[model samples]
Target: MVILTQACPIQRPFGSHLYKRRRDFQLLDKRSWSLKPLIPRVSEDQDTDYQLRAVAKLLADEMTANGQVIGIGTGVAVNEYLREISERLGDGRLSGVRCIPSSDVSASEAAFLGVPLTTIEDVNGNVDLMVDVADELDLENLAYIVGRGDNGPQANQPSLPRVRQLLEKARVRVVVVDIAKTGRRLGGSVPVLIEANEDIWEDIAEELDDIFIGDAEIRRRSVNPDAGPRGGNSPVITTDGNMVLDVQFLEGLKLFGKDEIYDRIVAEIETVDGVLEHGLVVGVARKAVVGTVVVSAIGEDGQEEVKEESGPRVVHL
Candidate 1:
């Protein structure tokens, strides 16, 4: 029954509605594309590794020979996709493909892998396809939780505002995740990570704490034992100089359930004055690729050996 007294309007949801089509190009029109039903591919190798590779290949197939302005997302699975795209670029299967990276780590990986890069402004903010991984994916609604710091603060994860911009501009937004990252219903098992203005982070956290019944805290930097507490020990600052707050939910609380409390809380948080961006990503992905691993055998050495590795499958969102 808690409420935010100074809440602002929640930002409009990011989705196909936000995409702007180029007058001259029909390829940018997502309506022209049709997603196929889930098709499972099985391989006999490292289940996780094979699944990641299969996903990378699937994303590479989305690129046309004429090239595409792709939005590259961060994380390990995404890195594998970048490598796949780079290999295709080297072999001339796809040319003129320019990538707009979502984070510093992704940009660096793309550059190192020889994937052509461009800015959103240079491309006039028109993206053919966006492929990024999700931290927590809602299978039914295609919603996800992003920016939860899988790579740590040094990875320079893109701010929520920037993510919003990229998603808004992209014509086809696709999310990739391992099957383990997905769930039919999202719950309070994960903290809701929020970014707020540095000056007002404490205030924002306090407000969120009240809303969540004292479940919010300002995320701090990890300190090296040898270095002790230095300036690095200060609160973690995002690439945009904003502070991140890890707001937990009451134990045993389930989100996105029958009561739809998740939607209500999200609206409340969005209205909070100093709130910048939040981790909950809903209605942004047009489709998702979920990588699954199946262990088909138990080896004599006590290691899991799959007779066949299950590859990732595409799910229409």
Candidate 2:
């Protein structure tokens, strides 16, 4: 839960119109913004759900051997990937693949769909490959921003350090995301998340400004009761009982150098007392499953019709 919401976009992206349900979504500066594009738009008709399946099938081709351990990341598109994997395994085309989910939400969904599941602590072997989602990705630099999901997954990110440890144990890493999620520049009102022990949140919040790249602000996410049980008037807690703080660059935001901006910001933040983890993940994925958009031109009169003309693009990392 990050409370730094930029000014509302004129219209949200096509595939990103999902409703928010978590009670911890209260924004601190609801009207703050940098007057820059938050997320670049794609003109093509986006069928991300379909594209995600296409990518999953491409991944299924790798589950050839028995007892493959796969790492699943959080995001709206993960369900689509899970469904595809479950179907393939059920049909006997794939076999003996146990999944390691990054979040509580992911574990429940994987089990409900009948996908074999295990935890990082229980697994005896390395993960074959990890297929997860990203919030903002710059393919050229292999840069990624994860854990910006709308609701539960946002809270789920406090567990990312554990996921990273497991990711290191994987032979390969892959990120599957709709192409609409990619952006050219690395700055804006993008949130940089932090998780720490609940008792030390205030200390961490006070030190955020020292590490921020520009005019960024931080706020602890609070939960309201009506939204859900785990959510209430108290500040929302991660599954690990940690407090979450969202650091959003408010204005004068700019990120250009390869690792200069990202690395410096992350390094400084990590040095902050009580800070445990942040949302920046870089150079891990060896492959990218990009869901491309194919927009058809308008004919004679002004009429629009959609069709799935292209499949996802698979780029080597």
Candidate 3:
């Protein structure tokens, strides 16, 4: 068993706990919310599009009219929800609400609908709310393995820094997601992606073997058309002009006793030359609102039963 040591405990932003409680809000309306029965319907068997729709409705309910919303990413799931929200607001109802999209792709889509564009810096330190999709999340509600869309780093560049700075100042931050992402243990299901500098790629890869009990490989990202000709066929690119290495464990490897794994990976690999940001996303969001989709099933007696399954749910944070 590999035991990684912790150099420093992650400090909780002051007043984070208080802000977490205060900011947390539920969007489901008991009166209006309804789930189609599964016995004859089998909604869960069909894909999680309904879950995504539910999440969109929930967001629309929570958002105030004529308010600013910061949207992150251009993934299919995120885009679908954004479209639903836009349609719900329709013409003049949300005219005063400006949507600051994190990625160019998202900005283009939102702009087509007359949604005003704002830079991430515009919402710096004081965004009314932010909605984004994630790759993985753990029990601590800490996110790992992000940046699926080619534009994640750029979109988050301004907003994330300012948000963290404000957390130190106001001491509050909120994150929201679906229940499926809330894993029981860290690293068991979700693979961690480490973004490092391309200069020391080989050295960092070698060090990961000593620090973790799993296989670690650099992430190769293909440049998108919008990124222009400067983008290369490099495997990974860090948010701060670095590289990304995706670490995966052998099948059936439990993530127990790996609390300090990130610390060791950071301490050892960061020492190498040309290393940049690791994919550790702890303390980024102080609070999370996890949305769950409950599919209804009709039993033989013609009664409806709600069944809960993990995954296949749209998330926001």
Candidate 4:
């Protein structure tokens, strides 16, 4: 029964009346475009690499083209999609795709895949599409949370990521997740990652601990940098060189009986002093490509067996 308190009204849920009109991937003007429901849902246990590749391929076909600037994010899913992009580029189906990477990890992967790489600076203009992964998805809410390794924080006076800048930089933000991760349900321990000032992370963590009580907890990511060559003795630093915070919310935690607690919490954290960018991505993802591998039918023994398929259809959300 945690509440947002008067301290943070921006996190407050807008009236249900307003949510009604805006629900269902309507961040962009609903009149602008329409998505085809070509792919259908399969199994709840649809967390497979093959399925992930299937999702990547769909995006590769739909989003990529020659002489386009693409923004790539870091993650296993992005890597797979990059492989698809490379295949297309290598075969000359797609050429001159100048990729803008969000992080160093993405840059390295794109380099290895032999995809032409560029930076936000060298984009020359707006990016054609930015593909990233989501740790969890709330279909009903039409929002997703990033930062679970499935996507991570610190503080003093809170700092906000120049989110406006990112929004202006990338033309379109599309989130891709496997079938299992897409639903009204929230998954994993870390819902959002916040980057904070190093000197005041202790206090920042304490503040979160107070506001988000119960199963909600804050963790600081650490790495040992002094052990040896591949050391692991220092706190993990972001590209911006800030401390990291992992915020976990209890399972099935909801507010206003219908709204997602994770969404609510992201709002509260933003109002806190010394806070920076959080992983709750809102308004960025206009369309989502969710791929599924459905194994149905029982064997002679009455047990369902795994089946292999290629180029599985994707459910566009």
Question: Considering every candidate listed, which one attains the maximal lDDT?
Answer: 1
2 against 3, candidate with superior TM-score = 2
Between candidates 1 and 2, the lDDT winner: 1
Please give the ranking of all candidate structures by lDDT, highest first, separated by commas.
1, 2, 4, 3
Could you give candidate 3's per-residue lDDT for residues 1-317 as a string of tens digits? 23334222222211121111111222222211111211111245545676566555544554334665454444455565567657756855554566655455666677776556665456563445455444444534344434434335434322233223322322112233344545633443222233444455554554443333333322333344333211255443434344444444443223222444333333444444444444444432222223244332222243433343333232233
lDDT of 4 at 213: 47
User: Candidate 4: where are CA atoms >4 Å away?
Assistant: 1-49, 150-168, 191-198, 224-234, 253-263, 284-317
The lDDT per prediction is: 0.55, 0.52, 0.40, 0.52
Backbone clash total for model 3 is: 11
Query: For residues 215-299, what per-residue lDDT tens digits would candidate 4 score against the true structure?
Result: 4555665554233311124665655666666665655443333444444545566656677667665442233333353222122
Q: How many angstroms is residue 216 displaced in model 4 relative to the true structure, after the best TM-score fit?
A: 0.9
TM-score of every candidate? 0.69, 0.67, 0.54, 0.65
Q: For residue 141, what is the lDDT in candidate 1?
A: 57
Clashes of each: 3, 1, 11, 22
Model 2 CA lDDT for position 85: 76
Writing each residue's lDDT as its tens digit, candidate 1 over 62-111 gives 43346688886777767888898788778877778888888878889999
| lDDT, candidate 2, 1-317, per-residue tens | 43322222222211132223212232222111100011112435645455555555544653224677888877555676688778878888678888888888888889999999987668765676566666666654456666643435345552566556655666555554445556544443333344545455555565554334235655565565343312234766677666666665554333221324454455555657676666666552233333342221111132322222345344444
Per-residue error for 235 in candidate 4, Å, reads 3.1
**Candidate 3 stretches greater than 4 Å from native:** 1-47, 140-144, 148-181, 188-199, 213-242, 251-273, 283-317
Worst 10 residues of 2 by lDDT: 31-40
C-alpha lDDT of candidate 2 relative to the true structure: 0.52
